[model samples]
Target chain A: MADAAAAPNADQYEEQHVHEVYEQIASHFSSTRYQAWPIVKSFMQELEPGTIGLDVGCGNGKYLAVNKDVFIVGSDRSSNLVKIAAQHEPHSAIIADSLVLPHQPGRFDFAICIAVIHHLSTPQRRQEAVKVILECLRDDGRALIYVWALEQKNSRRGWDEGDDQDVMVPWVLKTGKKNPMEDGATEKTFQRYYHLYRSGELEADVNAVGGGVVDSGYEKDNWWAICCKSESFTKASG
Target chain B: MKVLTLNFLTCAVKACKSTSTSFPLHPKDCEMVSDTIEPNPKLLYNILPRVNWTALLTTVAELGFPELPPNPPTIEELQADEKMTQELHTLLLETQISEGCLVCGNCGHAYAIKEGIANFLLPNHLV
Candidate 1:
C-alpha cells in the first residue's frame, strides 16, 4: 500500500504542493526586509559591472529591486511566484522550470540557484537540474548554488528507514528501520536530505560535469558553492 | 635601366616573402588571428551535440541575415531555399566565432569576444 506521502501520483502532488507553499511565502516576503536580501547582496557585490545574471528559483523579486542596473532575470516554476516576480520587477521575470530553462545557450554570464536543490525529491533530479542550468551559461560563465548541507548538525531525522533496494533515499535503510507511516509499505515517507561531502566529493561532482569550484562557504544551515565552467575540461571532452 | 629593374624586382620579392613570414604587428597578434580562424562547421559538427536554435537565429539576424525557418523547416522549403538551408547548416554545424559580443537576454551580461575568444571569467564572489 502507498504511504500518504507516496500515493500513486505522490511526486506530482509534492511538486505542486511545494510550489503552492512557495507562492504563499513569496506573497508575504516580497519586500527587501525578507531574509534573502543579505544573501543576494553578498552575491551581487562580487559581480562585475554590466554583467548578466540570473536568479534561479528566485521566489520573489526582492533581490532584483536592489540590482536593477545589471541585466538580471528572475525565474521560477510556480506561476504564482512568477506573477509576484513580474509584478515586482516587470519585464525581468520569467515563468520557467529550473530543470529546463527556456533560454538560449551561453545566454547568461552568471546563474544563482538559491536554497532550492534540497527541496528536490531525489539527487538525480537535483543533478539534472544543475546540468540544465549549466547549459544556459556561456563557456566561461559562473554559477552560484545553495543547497542543504548533509552535515551532522544539518541532517534531518527520519531520513534513513526504507527498503535497501531503493536508491532515491538510501538513508532510509541506515539501520533496517521500518517505514514510519504504514506496515509493509515499500514507499518511504521521510523528508530526504543529502549527506555532507566527505572531502573532494563536491569537487569531483563538479569536475565530472566540466565545472570547477571557484569558492564555497556556509551560512547557518545552507551550504553555498560557486562554480565556473572549465574550458579545458569541456574542450577535452569535445 | 635593366639593372634598376632587376633591383626593383628583387626588392619586391624580398618584401613579399618577409610580409608573408612576419606580420607588421606583434607576433601575438598573428597568433590571435590564426587562432581566430578556428575549425569551421564541417570540423565542429561532430564535437558539438546541441545547438540553441533561438540563439542561432537571433545571431544570424543580428548579422543582417534573414529570419530562420519556423520551428520546424519544411522539406519543400529546405529544397528550394538554398540560403536558408546554408544558414541553418552553418548555425547547426559551424564552430567559428561569427560575432564579437553576446548580450544575455536575461541578465544582460555583455560577453565580449576579443580576438574571437569569449572571456567568461567571473569575480570570485560572483562565482
Candidate 2:
C-alpha cells in the first residue's frame, strides 16, 4: 500500500510492468489464453446476431473468434497482440489504451473487459478504467468486466481473504533451443502488478463509477460482473 | 483497420471528446486492400442502423472511394437488392487500410496505421 501510494507516475509504472511485459511476451501469453472462460463464452453467445461490441484488453483476440455473427472491435495496449487479433476476419483490432479508448461515448451496443482491471496499480485508476468502459456503452448497452479475486485459496497461488490485495504476480518466460551447441533452456520471471478484488469490491468499484451491476459472480478464481450505464448518471450528465 | 472500424473511431484525446469534428478521422496517404470476405447480408442489415451514415460518407470520400449514396439504404432495401448488399460488403468489410495516418480535425493529432492496425497510443505529453 505504501509503495502503491507513492506511484506518482502510474502511467510510467504500468508502461514498464504491464505494457512492456505484454509486448515482449505476447506470443507466449497468447498461446496459453486460447480457451475462453465459460461465463464469458455464454455471455457472448447470448448476444443478438447483429450486435456490435468491443473486446477491451483483448489479448490475442481469442474471444474475437467466439461468435462470427456479431462484429467486435478488439483493442489492446500491445501492438503485437493487436497484430494477432487483426487476423480474426470480419472483426477488427487496433492498438489502444483502455483508459482512453478511441471509441465514441455511449455509442456501442455492448462491451466485454476480461481480466483487465486488476493490472491498474491504484484503486482510483481501477475505478477510472471502469468509468471509461461504462462511458463507451449506450444507455441500454451492457459491459461485462472480469478481475482477479483475492479469495482463491484453492488455486495455485493460494491467496485468500484478508491478504494484501496489491501484489506482484510473476510471469515466467522460458526461452532457449534444444541444440548441441547451445546451453539448456533458461527462465526469466517478470513481475506484474495486480489488485485482487475482495468479496464485493468489484461491485463497489462499479457503483463508484456510476455503473449498475446487473449480474456478478465468481468463476475460476476470478470475479466477474455484467454492468450497464446507470440511469441516474445519464440523467445527471445529460 | 477496416473502413468499417474507422467509422467508429475518433481522437483518443480527452479534450476532443466533446468536439464535433473529432468523429470520422480523415485518412492520409492510405494504402488500401480488398480481401474477398464472405458476404453476410444479415450482419450488414443489422449493422446498418447503428452506423453513423454521415461519418461513414466522410471516410469513404476521404479514402477516394466512389461516392456512396447520401443516405444509408434501409434494411428492406438492402435485403431486396443483392448488388447493394455486395457493394456495402465491399465497402465496409472487405476494404482494409493497410498503411496511413488518421488526422483529428479537433486537435490535429495524427495516429499512425501500419499492417492494418491503427496505433492510438498518445504520447506522454498528449496523455
**Top DockQ prediction, candidate number:** 2
Q: Pick the candidate with the highest TM-score.
A: 2
Q: What is the C-alpha RMSD of each candidate to the true structure, in Å?
A: 21.6, 2.8
Worst 10 residues of 1 chain A by lDDT: A165-174
- Candidate models: Cα lDDT each: 0.47, 0.88
In model 2, the clashing pairs are B1-B116
Off by over 4 Å in 1: A1-13, A29-33, A37-40, A87-91, A152-205, A231-238, B1-127
What's model 1's overall lDDT? 0.47
Chain B TM (all candidates): 0.42, 0.97
lDDT minimum window of 10 residues, candidate 2 chain A: A176-185
TM-score list, all predictions: 0.49, 0.95
Rate residue A71 of model 2 by lDDT: 91
